[model samples]
Target: MVGRGTILGVLGVLMAACGTPQRQDSGSESVEGRVIRPAGLAFPYVKRPACPGEGCAYGTWLACDTVSVYAREADTTERAFYLAREEPFQVLAGAVHVTRPEVVVVTRPTHQIGFQESGVLFQQGDTLFVLDYIAEGFFDAWYRDSIIETEIFWPWEHWYPAKDYEYGGDVVQQGVASFWIQVRNGSGQEGWVPADRASLASANSLDPDPPRCPARAE
Candidate 1:
């Protein structure tokens, strides 16, 4: 039979290889990385230490001091949003420089709301840039919400072509729709357009990453 020590040692190696992170505590070290989270899809970024109250942003995610969600799941109803710098590095949506050790991600609040301020934050050289680059390829991004008893017959728009990235066919949805990604620039300018008609990069422009990530099916 395998000894307990041997079994534990094997488990440790497997966890490390899978990149399972250890728990982080407060006042951890700061991290930095290049904002290589894909150019086409806008990323949701917010400042650290968000406050809750009447002044808080709308909706459920950022509505409280903590970052918990009310999604339907048995074993995973609420997950803690880490305020530490190291935690965000694990869930970065895009690939960063393989040479940069890791994407030392920080300020990843549990909820992501799309606005002009949506983009990943990273340090490139001495500059602090907020990248709002939208991908060139066109895909259907849905904006959905439920209607209560009084909200029946509410006018809504659905994507007909869905490829043009245009919304028309104003009608009512029976159930509800999911959240949609709306691009906003650092200057507070907003627009929802096709890939060809997308607004310019929100801040300090980044030269397109040679070729896009082939693995990204979206």
Candidate 2:
């Protein structure tokens, strides 16, 4: 009969030969062993809505398991989402391979102001113009409402239409100086109003830069 110690020793050897339990591939393409980040590669994480069934929306602030990794390359950055398990390395590796042939990354700074800095305050029945100097045209306008309003304007558009404008926000980015102001109408919808149409609530309120209009013919 085998001694207890001998039997236990044999069992230990058998377990070692079997090796660590193989990780079940969660149907996702992943490596079986340790994953290492490539040299000189940097990835940044961004927050987004989690999977619908994961119950992340109602849970902790950062309870979402879905992580978006932006892998930066020489000229371009590739974006990928990974389902984080115990580790994110394996998922990252897979993302990097798929997004090869790096794409260039372009970034810009956004400037935001508060209510105090909003160009002017206007009331209902005022008409405001959406000016575009480059196009030399007034594309759209807003009919002011009664409620206090805010606006968010983009700097790039030569002409930004009021219909496309965002309302009820305190952020105003560097955009063309067309006298974009915030106003509300009877429907309670607020938007950017042109300074030319609406009179400022106070001279002390923020003022818009002079309109960059085309020069008059001699």
Candidate 3:
């Protein structure tokens, strides 16, 4: 029979191998890279301390305080997992479960696959603020209440073409019906054209003033 310790060791190895992650670009510059000091911050910025003692068990975590670790799940749920300053943990799957309020989790093997460094894992319970960079492709924002607000881009136009012709139509005389006017692509972009300036010939352009001529005898 396999011992519990052996099973745990094998599981840990498997997790370490498969759970390794690539540098996930959250599209946020701050979270996209390595952990660095927030500029203009004071010294001795009390980080959630690492596990001071050895042999700390999993789920042994710190309190919720400053930043936090959250996952946008497949079901579209944002769950927060409280973490300690020093526990190293990688996000495998599922919603985060937190006992303490403001704890961060540190990961092992530093920057390898399945290894995540100290992730800020505490929530302030304040109004969650999110900045969406539309240019950068953030179309939606997720809230703790599980409400997702999405933004869509729509452009407006002043004029639209009524018709479309595959090839330019035959050139017609200035006043001829077949002149510059031709059907355009229905789905094409809109552009404006002056009715009067459609053709250089007198026929195409409607005369501003009417010439009153007597009717010819039939």
Candidate 4:
């Protein structure tokens, strides 16, 4: 039998429950993260995902799912920087693993199923929050939304876009986006990494070990 707690994307559940996306305030650091990716290769930070050719300030290499940030000024020089392999960096801006209570809400009513849901509920303090969600019934994909506002974009003109970026699902498929986290090391050097390249370190994690997520409201 399907569990009653089945959960799933951006909706009222997102606004109603998880009000306002978590973000680092101007000049105020919030969540902490680390970059240890590109795997065997040392992590690469680009001046901008704008590598038009080997002529770019950082030289041609800004391809794949890379992340970027708005330079306080428009200085495009010094585009790329390679960090020490497997070093810890601070997430200037990124998602934090938060602990909160979750509940299921039916968003769409169907003939076969009682309802369809796009998000799950969670609580912070006395307020509620929601995380985007999906199931395998009518939708093959989950998480629908735009990253244009979040500075996460895919298919930089410099590099080849992902072959499967189109992704399936008409209504169910969220708009395409590539996520990269803005990070800074101890030397105050800041760079961007594809979401996959970074890892959350305990030194500055928002949540403690064995995250105590809030319980579902009965």
Candidate 5:
């Protein structure tokens, strides 16, 4: 439960919640489960849509059986933040705790989960309109309906087009292309395997996306 306070003051209230359940782990923060709703904040609107069938366009929100957990402040360059399962957090001044990792745990009046690590937290806010940004940006720049099939008829001449494009003139562009290739391949394969193929097995198991997502609904 996010602790009670005004929207502007909730930020400071979170800091106080840090030391509430005073535990003495050298690196662990305090966790006091004080629940409070933000003043004038609207109640959460919960929606659960069925999984898409054969040709239905995938909805922006996906379902999750377990609470979704992520590294706090993923946009930041620092990598020191990570949250634990059942970790308590505040959203719109209400406190909600994740019961399991990687599942979608719905908390209202915010109707979303916040991954808190150290002093920072990360979650989708309706105000960001990030999905619109992604869709627009993807279609505007990255999306290509037509397949770009480049036949390497002259592999000998352009086997390493990237090098030629960047440093063929004189300076060496360094060998980060290998890193990028690895990243691209890794990202494409980053999904859960079917339970039959994996060590765990369950029918109601969740995918990587959050369940009952309220962020992209606007």
Candidate 6:
């Protein structure tokens, strides 16, 4: 018979080796000779509706928050956008864009620990956009509630308090994809755009030389 201690030890080792379980769709891939995994941000404590019918004991529930992570080719500066599974790094280059290339700064948020530290910067005409770096990860939080109610006893009614806080939100899986960029257009309007929509600026020049239009054949 296997001992309880032995089983726990083995489980601990397995968890340590696996680190965090990644999403099923997110498999490991190789990029520039380095192994990359899918990763994303995870939000916890989102309110959700409870199940319907008499079987449903809990009133309301919480939902899980899942986000995708993406990456792009490294630029001339050897900087690239990656997930926050590991340590933070700097990305010196931005992706190519239709408009003039602009210098963008990528930095990890100080609040996000144990995650990547890279972001993208875009400059379109006089408008500049910044995408603050956030690590791709998730966590599970448990919440509970206690209720007081009247119970039927032998020839009498009794008051009792019940506890029912054993519900766990949702499982968080690890994955990677491009982060979203916050855009502030020339008109001062702000919006969120996916990282893939615009390429990072390779050069810092506000008005880089534009690609010449092709000449039509006579």
lDDT of 3 by residue, 14-90 (tens): 11111112232232212213231112222222112111111212221122122233333212144344333332232
TM-score per candidate, in order?
0.17, 0.15, 0.12, 0.26, 0.13, 0.18
Over 84-184, each residue of candidate 5 has an lDDT whose tens digit, in order, gives 22222221111111111010111111222212212112122211100000010010000011111111111121134554542111110110000000000
Query: By TM-score, how accurate is candidate 1?
Result: 0.17
- lDDT (0 to 1) per candidate: 0.19, 0.21, 0.19, 0.25, 0.17, 0.20
- After superposition, candidate 3 runs with Cα above 4 Å error: 1-82, 94-135, 140-218
TM-score rank, highest first?
Answer: 4, 6, 1, 2, 5, 3
Number of the top-ranking candidate, with TM-score as the measure: 4
TM-score of candidate 3 versus the correct structure, residues matched by position? 0.12
Question: What ranges in model 6 sit over 4 Å off?
Answer: 1-174, 198-218
Kindly report which residue stretches of model 4 are placed more than 4 angstroms away from their true locations once superposed. 1-79, 95-175, 197-218
| lDDT for each residue of candidate 1 in 195-216, tens digit (9 for 90 to 100) | 1111111111132222111132
What's the CA error at residue 11 for candidate 1, in Å?
39
| lDDT tens readout by residue for model 2, 1-218 | 12211211211211112122222213222222432111222222111211111110111111023333333321124543332322212110100011110111112322333234444433222222221111112111111211122232332222245686543221111111222222232343332222211112212112232112223359
- TM-score: model 2 vs. ground truth: 0.15
lDDT of 1: 0.19
Q: With candidate 1 superimposed using the best TM-score fit, by how many Å does residue 116's alpha carbon deviate from the native? A: 26
The local distance difference test score of model 5 is 0.17
Tell me the TM-score of model 6: 0.18
Least well predicted 10-residue stretch by lDDT in candidate 1: 145-154
